[model samples]
Target chain A: MRDVAIVAFAQSNCQRDAGAQNEVELIMPVLTEVFKQTGIKSAQDVDFTCSGSCDYQQGAAFAFVAGVDALGAVPPIKESHVEMDAAWALYEAWLKIQMGSAESALLYGFGKSSPGELPIVLSQQLDPYYLAPLWVDTIAFAAMQARTMLDSGEITEADMAEVVARSRNNALKNPHAQLKGDQTVADLLKEATYVSPLRRHDCCPISDGACAMIICTIEKAEEWGKPYAIIKGIDHRIETHHIGSRDLSRSVSTEIAGKAAGVANGPVDVAELYAPFSHQEIILKKALGLGDDTVINPSGGVLAGNVMMASGLSRIGEVAMRIIRGEAKRGVAHATSGPCLQQNLITVLEAK
Target chain B: MAQLAAVVGVGQTKYKTKRKDVSIAGMVREAAVNALEDAGLTWNDIDAVIIGKAPDMFEGVIMPELYLTDALGCNGKPMLRVHTAGSVGGSTAIVAATYVQSGVFKRILTVSFEKQSESNAMWALSNPQPFSPHLNAGAGGYFAPIIREYMRRSNAPYDAGIKVAVKDRLHGAKNPLAHLQLPEITMKEVEDSPMLWEPLRFLEACPSSDGACAMVIANEELAAKSPRKPAWIRGAAMRSEPTMYAGREQVNPRAGIDCAKDVYAQAGIHNPRKDLDCAEVYVPFSWYEPMWLENLGFADEGKGWELTMSGATSLTEGGDIPWNPSGGVLCSNPIGASGMIRFAEAAQQVRGEAGDHQVDGAKTALGHAYGGGAQFYSMWVVSSEKA
Candidate 1:
């Protein structure tokens, strides 16, 4: 495969409502930042542009078309979109580069999760005939998974609370984080349950946000004279949709994707995990076989502030930023979609 | 470096106003199974799955591919979902082809569909947003002004739209799977149709359809092992521009023109009219037949209607350069699937498997789709011979 690198990244601050600011307003700032960082102007600078977003996030048909306003795609520019997280958009852009279709690409993801009932809105992603009609919230689905692990002696409520505590503590250093507080596991465990066996603190905060990034060939990285992170490997895998068909406590798909992404090829100095629920962080850590050596979620991860479509790409961006800042030499990023993490994507990034 | 890719299999469900016999998953599976069978492969042999649909409101299933991965055999495999407005179908195919063209996967399954009957598409489409109030004008109402402007600029006869309506419906009649089979349609019948949008008769607009289309794309080595002939992919391109900008041309969008130019350039075509044996352009409205003709370089600016006046686009008289021989969107428009149908039909013609809708001796063809008020454009060129 052709060598591709992450040259620039930017994101909006996580907000509860972002009132009056539509999708375009939420996106333009990040786009402007990435453009400035890369010393490029508009979509014309890149050979391709791809976005990751969902219509359900906005509750309108063809809602994603409105996002094009942020790009000012005049005189027309090559572009595509995925009804997925921006990490998948990066995957597509990576393939475009490898295929020699283009030398550079701009990728973005955005969502306003505050507009609707976040968990209930996600119920529509379930099997329509079997599960969605019943209106089971996604939080309940994750709760069941957490309970499964709890009953199996895999983890305790304190362990889950500790993960949340670590995430919030890590957010102290992350200025973009929406929720950040220094708290002990005992303090987190004192909170009441929002869903059975799961405290409200264990779940990610619903926030409105958008993120943008630009990637280019390795040669372009040097020509631009900017620090970059090489994407050493990336892969994604999915499990059966039937929630009852597999054990919710284990992430077979994440393990398979982790293997495919070649995460073990080198020492992982830092890892950005997209575990919206506290328990999922432990599950992914086990699935990827990461020991205490890998420092997880230096940016507090999505658990501190979840931006839906943007969070996955944020994981990638967060890790790449660490590499660019000379904080870590190598890292891993993960993104998930569907109830209880039915779909998972893993990417391995390395500093030059 | 990019590797070669080819379309070795194509499949579709019968175009209908409503597919009540099966659920959404079943509907997509029908097309997938048929495609796999056509390619002489099974679900286990596929390496990845890429699906596309216009919007979740059409079926009320947000990211339907999540629920669909099982039926597609995507377990422990990469599954990507694409959404690019109405052009998503074509864009999805482009993304799927890249998995192979990039030498990442040997075989991939790509599918696009729209179950418009599951929910009210018109209401879903006009859902008011924070910045814009509900106009309540459906797609036709939105495009009527553009159609009128095209007529004024080109000086097209009042009967130009009527002729295209009758011509495509007749082509639809030849295909058994078409939703509206009007083999004996006439100009008088079209003229009497209700005028929903001024100068646009009810018959001139495409019908809402419930259908799905699927294709199996493979790398050079896997495609060479296929039982049937493969449609060699020459070029694929996509373009987008901002909507409602000042001094922008809505009738003949720059995005469409640029997209066509990019694809034609990759295919080594200096003149589209002669290089392409046929075309399956997206024409939801009859007037687009002429508008796109000029935009796609098939005709000169302001002179595209002459080709229509001379019956040059008709399969019977157009000889080698027929457009929408399979009746097209007007005959069966499952919105999202419509674009892939155009793409699959292009592949079918080159593979000599289009049945009755086949353009005689078609060796090269173009598949085109545009979406989001004509700001998003995706097109591809395919030939019987390798690029």
Candidate 2:
């Protein structure tokens, strides 16, 4: 396979509501930032462009079509879109490069989650015949998983509280985080339960945001003279969609994808995981076999600020940025979709 | 160099106004199972699954792939969902091909579907945005002006669209799975149909359909061992421009032109009309047939209508280069699946499996689909023999 690297990454600050700012407006700033970092004029410079987003975020069909307006795609460009997280968009772009179809690619993901009842909107992702008709929201599903873990002695409420405490403290250094603060584990544990055994702080905030990344062949990275992180391996796996079919406390797909992505090939210095619920971070850590040496969620992860379609890509961006800045030598980034992480992707990045 | 890929199996659910007998998962499974049966493989033999659809709102399901994992047998495997508007079907097929072409997976199952009976597509497409004008009601309302511009620039005969409608419907009659089997449809009948949009009559527009299309793509190694002949993928390309921009050519969009040029060049076709044996271009409206013919290099600008008038694009009429021999979007438009149906039909022609709609001795064919105000385009060329 041709050597590929993430050369630049940029994202908008997570907001409770990006009022009146449409998808194009939410995306343009990040696009400009990535271009500035790469010293490129527009998407015209890239061999391919792809994006990931959902129409339900805007309450309309084909909502992603508006995002092209931000790219200045006037001369016509090779492009595609996925109704998925941008991390998968990166995967598609990587495949294009692997097939010798493109030398470089520009990819982005965006979402306005504050417009709708985020959890209810996400419930539609469940099995239509069995679960979606009941409108079992996302938080309710996560709570059930948390309950399962607690009852099985896999984790304690204090452990979940500690994850939330650390996430909040870590987000203090992340300017783009939507939820951040210096809070003690005891303080978090004191919060009233929003759902049985789960507090409001345990769930990620609904935020509107966009993120962009530029990837290219290692040769192009050197030619551009930008500090970059090589993508060593990337793979994704999906589990059965039936919520009752699998163990709710463990992420089987994550383990499969992590193994496939070669996460254990090297020592992980930093790990950024898309764990919308605080307990999921613990679940992913165990699945990936990360040790105490790994600095997990240095950017507070999605628990601090989840941007829906963009958050998955952000996990990857966080790890790549750490490597580019010489703060970490190797890292693992993970993204998830579906209730209780039915689908999971693992990307391993290393510094040059 | 990229690995070679081929379509070893193709399957599609019967196009219809509503598939009342099956649920969404059952409907999609039918196509996937048919494809697997054609490939002489089971669900476990596939390496990955990639699905595509126009929008989540169309079925009131957000990212339906999450729920479809079991139906497609994607458990413990990589699955990707693509959504590129109307071109999603063709784009999804290309993505599946890339998995094999990139040497990432040996065999991939790709599916595209739309169950329009579950929700109102017209309403889903016509949602009012905050700043965008709500003047256009549905797709027809939006494309009527573009069609009018094409008519004025080409100065084509008014009967040109009527001729295409009758021709494609007649072709549809030969395909048992097609939604509209208008065996006796005539130009005179089309002319008398009610006009929904100017220059577009009821019969000239595509019907709303519920359907799914699927294909099993494999590497050259696996394809060679297949029980049936394979359609070798010659080339694939996609292009996109902003939906609207200053001085954009809506009648003959640059995206479609560039996409065709790139794919033809990859397929080593210097002249599309002479090289490609047949084509299955997306023509949701009849007038788009001639407009795309010119854009796709089948004919010179302003002369595509002459080819239509000469019956050069008709299969039953013994045309040298037939278009949509298995009917087309105008006969069975399941929105998202429409594009892949075009692509699969093209492959069928090359594989000599198109049954009654077969273009005689077709060795090479082209499949094309466009979406999002004609700004997004996906096209591929397939040949019976490997290059």
Candidate 3:
């Protein structure tokens, strides 16, 4: 396979509400920023374009179509899209570059989670015939898993609060974070619960945002590189859609993807994980076989701002930024989709 | 760097304006089963499933793929959903094939569909969002201005587009699966058709059809052993550009041209008009046949209309590069599925399976689809002989 690297990255601000700006309006600025910083003058120069987004966010069909205007897509360019997160879109583009079909590729993902009742909207991702009809919101589902973990002594409310505290404290340094403060674990534990066993702090804030990443082959990577992180390996896996079919407390998909991407082999200096819910972080860490010594979510991660599709791609970008800055030699970035991380993708990036 | 891929099987649902007889799951299954049958395989033969559709609003279902897992026989298997506006069908197929080309999955089932009967496509397409003014009504509303630009640039006669509409509709007569089969469709009738968007007569545009198209793709080895003759995939390419940009050419997009050139190079075709036996190009509107003909390298700049006028795309006329023998998108369009239909039709022609609309002696064919203001493009070349 040909070498590919994340050459540039940009994103819109993470916000609680996207009042008038829809998906397209939200993503346009990010597209410009990504290209502007990369010094790529023409959209025509990009060989392939791929995106990660869902139709539910816009409450409209073909929501991604409107995004074309943002890319200045006239004079058509090779493109593809995934209903998954933008991180997976990046994976697709990486494959294209590896196949030698494209020299450089653009990847983006966005979602406006504040328009309607986000928890209710997310319920639609459940099994349509069975679980979805129950109208169980995401918090309720997470609470149930939390209860299982609590009963099994795998984790505690105190541990959950610690995760929340550490994540929020870390977010104080991130300018794009939607939530950040120096709240202590004891104080977080005292917060009111949105759902039983799951406090507001335990859940990722509903965020509206968009993000873009540019990747290229080794030669193009050199052309665009001021600093870029090479994607060493990337892979994704999906478990059964039936929620009850698998153990809810474990993320089998993450394990599979991590193994496939070679993340399970050894230790990594940094890790960026998409854990919208606090307890999910614990689940993900175990699935990925990360030790306590590994520094995770140095970029504040999704717990600071959960922008659905964009958060996943942002994880890769965050890790790549670290590699670019010479902060880390190797990093593992993971993204998840579906209920309880039913689908997961992992990418291992390294500095050459 | 990439492994070769082949279209081992192809399938499509019977095209219609409303497919209310079955649920969304049933609709997808119809096409998937047909594809499996063509590949001489069963549900277990597929290692993964990739699906595409225009939008959630089109069918009043959000992220319908989650609900459709069982319908497409994706249980305990990898499933991906792709959405890139109108060209999603084509892009969806490309992603599925990539799995095989990347040597990840041996056999993959890719499908695209839209059930327009469940909801009004016009209203869905025009559904106003926040910030953006509701200027465009439907797809035609956005494309009409581009079409007008094409008219001015080409300096083609007004009758040129009307002729395309008449020809495609006439071709639709032979396609049992085509939605519009106006046996007496004439240029005079198209000229009299109602104008929804300026310069775009109603009859010249594609009808909103409820349909699905499915294809089974495999590696060279599996394809060679398939029960049916495989349409060896010579090349596949996709491209995209921003929808709104200063100096952006809407009439003949650079992405389309670049995509065509990329795919042709991969297929090792230097002269498309002679190298390709036939083509199933995406032409949601009648005039698109000639426009895309030029875009796809079948005609010179500003002379694509001449090919349409010369009857080079007719079904029985035996034109060198017979285009849309299956009547094309002007006859039927389930936005999400339209691209795959072009691909499936191309494969069908190569397989000698297009019963009535079959172009005789078709060996090498091109399938093309574009969406999102003509920004997203997905195309492929298939030949009877393996490369």
Highest lDDT: give the candidate number: 2
Clashes per candidate, residues 3 or more apart or on different chains: 0, 0, 21
Per-candidate Cα lDDT values, in order, are 0.91, 0.93, 0.84
What docking class should model 3 receive? acceptable
What's the DockQ for every one of the candidates?
0.87, 0.88, 0.47
lDDT tens string, model 3, A1-352? 5557788898777899988886668887888888887888656678878888877786766677677667665555566778878887887777676566678888899998776888898887775556778998778878988988999999999989888898999899999998999999989988898898899889999889999988887787777655789888887767776666778889977887788788856669999999888999999999989998889898778889989889999999999988988999999999987777777889999997
Ranking by lDDT: 2, 1, 3
Residue B177, candidate 3: Cα error in Å is 2.8
Residue-level lDDT tens digits of model 1 in A1-352: 6668999999988887888888899999999999999998888899999999888877777767889988988878899999999999999999999899989999999998877888999998999999999998889999999999999999999999989999999999988899999999999888889999989999999989999999999999999999999999999999999888989888999999999989999999999999999999999999998989999998999878889899999999999999999999999999999999999999999999
Is 1 or 3 the stronger prediction by DockQ?
Answer: 1
lDDT of 1 by residue, B1-387 (tens): 689999999989999999999899999999999899999999988889999988888899999999998888888899999999888889989999999999989999999999999988777777787687676887888899999999999888999999889989988998888999898888999999999999899999999999999999999998899999999999999999987799999998999998998999999989988999899999999999999999999999988888877888888565557899999999999988889999999999999999988898999999999888888888989999996
Name the lDDT value of residue A184 in candidate 3.
93
Look at candidate 2 and tell me the lDDT of residue B122: 84
B123 in model 1: Cα distance from truth in Å? Answer: 2.0
Per-chain TM-score of chain B, candidate 1?
0.99
TM-score of each model, paired residue for residue: 0.99, 0.99, 0.91
lDDT of 2 by residue, B233-286 (tens): 999999999988999989989999999999999999999999999999999999
For model 3, the DockQ equals: 0.47
lDDT of 2 by residue, A39-153 (tens): 9999999999999998898886788899999999989999999999999999999999999999999999999987799999999988888899899999999999999999999
| Runs in model 1 lying further than 4 Å from the true structure | none
**TM-score for candidate 2 (chain B):** 0.99
